[model samples]
Target: MQHKHGISPRMEHYSCMVTLLGRAGKLDDAYDIINQMPFEPDGCIWGSLLGSCRVHGNVVLAEPENASNYVLLSNIYAYKKMWDGVNRLRDMMKTVGLKKEKGCSWIEIKNKVHMLLAGDSSNPMMAAITEKQ
Candidate 1:
């Protein structure tokens, strides 16, 4: 696409390339590309690698030593329905003193906005919601 459009590669370009290559199971290639980057790789780059690792069911790349990567790995594992991986990530976070933020959601009904927080029982429909779920 770049060649056809006469566009030059940039950080965004490299990031997308790394993500695609990692998703395709070319981890070494992705890692090489990341290493070649002039600046330090950030959380986004690590997230791409960790997501790909989870998709491929390869936990080796999700080691807890890399905290940022571990967070992404945990999210990916959660999406992939891997309870064990999620639990491992939770444990790692606890051990490292990384507090996992509580999840929250908001909904609007009859022009009124309702908010829900993890473990909060303030909602009037809390009983119904819990029963349904």
Candidate 2:
């Protein structure tokens, strides 16, 4: 379709293809696409591929230093109840001092913006919120 429209494939396009292929259990095809891309695959591309691998229970891909990549892989291992894999990933992160950045989100309620962070418990109302939830 891109060729028909004369729109050259970009990194995002290749990444999408990899993701689709991975989700379809066509991991080999996805890997081949990554290898055959005209340009170097960026972290996003690799991350997508890794996510697919996690879903499909394949861990043959190379590990990148990106914290998010490790997090996704660790989650995958955890999903499969593979404590060894999870511990190994955790150890690697600790050895390299690679910490995943805390994610934050904000919401506006009645003209007031409230901020929240992943695993954040600093808020004074956290206990109340937790009890309510």
Candidate 3:
């Protein structure tokens, strides 16, 4: 597209390619694309690769300051029943004095935003939402 169509590769295009390649287990290629990007990889780009890593059970690291990445990686290991990985990750965190941050998410509904936190079932619609799922 860049050479033939004279179109420049944008972040979104790179993100899509990374998602596709990573999901297909072409992790190396996906990473290569990220490294070749004209700009620094953003959260979405890294998130795509991390998600693929989770699916394929491949251990990978993301932003060092983002505790969520470590938690997600640890959870992936737990899902795969890899006790050693989970233990090692926890031990590493302890050694580094890194604490897991509580997960929080927000959704917009009718132009109003609602926030929910992990392990907190205080949302008014929690019961209905849980039932629907």
C-alpha lDDT of all candidate models, in order: 0.76, 0.83, 0.81
Better of 1 and 3 by TM-score: 3
Model 2 residue 122 CA deviation (Å) reads: 16
In candidate 3, what are the lDDT values of residues 9-72, reduced to their tens digit? Answer: 8999999999999889998899999999999988778878888888887775433334556676
Candidate 3 — which pairs collide? none
- Which runs of model 3 end up more than 4 angstroms from their true locations? 60-65, 91-133
Quote the RMSD, in angstroms, for model 2. Answer: 6.0
Which 10 residues in a row give candidate 1 its minimum summed lDDT?
60-69
Candidate 2, residue 10: CA error in Å? 0.9
lDDT string for model 1 (1-133, tens) is: 6679988777787889889999899887888898898788776777787778777766666544356666767877787788998898889787878864565788775777777898889899666555742
Model 2 alpha-carbon drift over 4 Å, by segment: 1-3, 103-133
Quote the lDDT for 127 in model 3. 68
**Candidate 1 vs candidate 3: which has greater lDDT?**
3
RMSD values, in order shown: 8.1, 6.0, 4.6
Residue 81 alpha-carbon offset, candidate 2, angstroms: 2.6
